[model samples]
Target: MTKNILFIMFDQLRFDYLSCAGHPHLHTPNIDRIAERGVRFTRAYVQSPVCGASRMSTYTGRYASTHGAQYNGFPLRVGEMTLGDHLRPLGMDCWLIGKTHMRVDAEGMERLGLSPDSVIGARQAECGFDVWCRDDGLWAEGPDGFYDENRSPYNEYLKSRGYPGENPWADFANAAVEGGDIASGWFMTNANKPANIAEEDSETPWLTGEAIKFIEQAKGPWCAHLSYIKPHWPYIVPAPYHDMFGPNHVPAAVRHDSERDNPHPVYAAFMNNRIGRAFSREEVRQKVIPAYMGLIKQCDDQMGRLFDFLERNGRMQDTMIVITSDHGDYLGDHWLGEKDLFHEPSVKVPLIIYEPSPDADATRGTTCDALVESIDLPATFIEVAGGKVPDHIVEGRSLLPFLHGKTPENWRDYAISEYDYSTSPMAAELDVAPRDARLFMVTDQRWKFIHAEGGFRPMLFDLVSDPNEFDDLGDSADHADIIALMYDRLGKWGRRMSQRVTVSDEQINAARTGGKQVGILIGVFEPDEVPPAASSKYRGPVPTKEKD
Candidate 1:
């Protein structure tokens, strides 16, 4: 039986970047070890391609549309339940060790009269987690001021370690010390230089130490969401990891000249995005990819340290480990920069789950090619805790069967992803209304379809024929039937009963049974068509006319 859960998430990690997943140069043996011990999902995708919304979906086991945190920095409306909410009922405590990228639902809290400092209020404010440490990790200060509202604990730690600056997170932690000058990590050119901070003091290692400390002191059943903020942006690594890779180690961009020729309107808009434009240059990629690889390598090394700690403490036998990412960076794929589009590189992520039980031993070092989603983690955790998965609450099916080495029948055929660009500058440039600035993606094994709101034509790619997703078959009349079928699937998904939280399932079921006893026939056609008990009330209806 699994006594604990260690849910780990890496920020902006690509699906094919790991050694086990066949990256030519960037090897991640520590992560691959988890895959070796359990099952690796090859086709797992996130609910969204952006950080905030994607993490919200993963935490809540629901789509971005259902959670209503559809974009970065968007609040996950109060009263929305998360993994913490689901597991707490089962006597499992959920604690945060690192970043959640959660923006509190302040407006909802205000309306409900919840104090931000109170215990329950704080849990609600911090996405239902009891905070061991909460840091969004981006403590950047510009001329306009700090990019975030909350104080970064990582920055405070750097300050305590004797790094001097108003923003040491940038000056030392992310910057390269070059002959008394601080080279900002945000510049791609500075990626080759090592960060000023010591390797042990780097973000990944510090967070790993914090998590180990938490586990050592923690009692009873608990889950530590060890979220790492690295390989995301400000691409710079500390010490040995900084010197690990070079320009030759970076792979060629997955873009082509055909993508630039008469692209779809929304696609073209993304291709022309500022980040996309910058990454399109080969020089920028060569300089930055090495740093990104270094950060990942450091993360993997920290994982080795973390695993060693668990083994030393004898906790490895009881903990169920899940390794995944919130979303993938475009990294110049498909003529894009960040993760916003529905291409495989942006939305698909590496998912590895290791259930520490004899039952899962049969599937060790195996790969599962089922279509999995980031939302499935909540249900998986709940099940691992030996609790009943509340079907009405969690939108995803549990992966317990898979973990037990059983292939489930009648699984979902398609994986879905959504993106809301209303708050993006692209909406302003394209003159799209916030309400209409949305896109939905539906994909099976062979075909991928993208449906944009506001009268925009759908984008379709036959993934079998065009694996790179460079060609747009939306304009081709030959694929019209396929496009219509995909739209139908999207429509079916949209029509699901979402945000229906007013009544419990038991109450709804009770109404069905209780109504029949009171001579009420739901969906009754003719008077005689009702049940015999219900017919009693209708047969005596003539008495009402006599009274009148």
Candidate 2:
């Protein structure tokens, strides 16, 4: 049977927030339902904690170092092969229904003479997906202009429905009405108040409706990426949902006073940053956490709607449904508000994949603790669409074998995450060079090591001893052996074949011995030293040098 893929991604959703993941307050029955029918990966991490870099990794099936789109506004280069590039060859149509957080490499495209109007160029510009509807959903307007320069369809929709403002995305959808004054949701104080818009017009529900419309009209054998941009920032929800949770329901922040005592310079810089300082306050957490929970609850309800639509249309039987997030929100965890650190709240995300084929029956509803990366999704989609994963380009291994209740040989022992902070204020505050303002996290089952570029020492967390990551062992002399071992692993990963994308392993192996057939043999001392078949052409064509 021809397979279809429904890839659903939520923005800033934590791995532990769902009811299935043991969250005590938030009940996500729809998301839990997906987990019940599929395998929930407990240890899945994104290649980067931030949205754009993580999404780029997910789309290209490569790490941030490989793809070179290492931050929010960084562009995925024009020639990088993405999920659509891989699956489209096998007669699978790849499409985007909502946000990709993908910035087009206009400079690279211009150098290559690729027009965004052309089919291939359009795909390349859109991170390889054919655009059904594209919205990055950050419509915040500053003094200069809107955060996203792209035209806002969401704003237009809000206007058409009589939302009274030039930017209803900020006015009605993201702001609260306080005594006839518009209280911007950008501030955490307004987070407890209901947004001025109706619930149906909120970003999550609107995006869900867009997804259902796309699936309803789409042809079979397709991969539709439904990426939502809510539960991210502007942490305010519409009425009813806004009051769903309060300060009482908010979990205690996962942090300690000891974490701030003589912290690593890099970590300290992040902690002292504006966002971190704000979230470090108890009042901010009390105001923001409840609204954040409400946004997720709204998303779960939309999931129920979308799933019910799929069931009614019989799309569930043929579609491989995947539910995951770009990355988790820090949400005051480790005294951080955003996802720019290597902590579990910032890097680890929820990953649930339901393969509709009976081959996946053996592993249904199981939980896998294997160290999985976000890059694995594209590899999984390529395999599901009946295409061989091009290992030279796609760095991630297919998860199909795991879904079929088999462990693939030589499975990865660790997961990697990268953060490029050159463009961030933290870099400037620390006086770091642009090239040196970077952090790499390599985490296994026992330890999580963070290697910061420049002259700073590495940060170490003994996950076995302190799973909550309260203690730092980077400065401890007793753990020198373990730190050295982790450094060796990081060096080995740095030497990976990230740029050898033009040739496959098979091609390299075939070319190794086939060179002699074209009379390019090297290191041959005598005719007898080489194979007879290889020396045949040289034997017949002996040319004597003319006296000169």
Q: Tell me how far the alpha carbon of residue 264 in candidate 2 is from the true structure, in angstroms, after superposition.
A: 0.5
Error of 2 at 275 (Å): 0.8
Off by over 4 Å in 1: 502-507, 514-548
lDDT of 1 by residue, 315-385 (tens): 98999899999988888878788789999889999899988899999988999988898888898888888
lDDT of 1 at 501: 61
Q: CA shift at 182, candidate 2, in angstroms?
A: 1.3
Error of 2 at 486 (Å): 0.6
* Tens-place lDDT digits, model 2, residues 379-447: 899889998999999999999998989999999988899999999988998999999999999999999
State residue 425's C-alpha deviation in candidate 1, in Å: 1.6
Q: What lDDT, from 0 to 1, does candidate 2 have?
A: 0.91
**lDDT score, candidate 1, position 63:** 92
Clashes of each: 0, 0
Q: Candidate 2: lDDT of 108?
A: 93
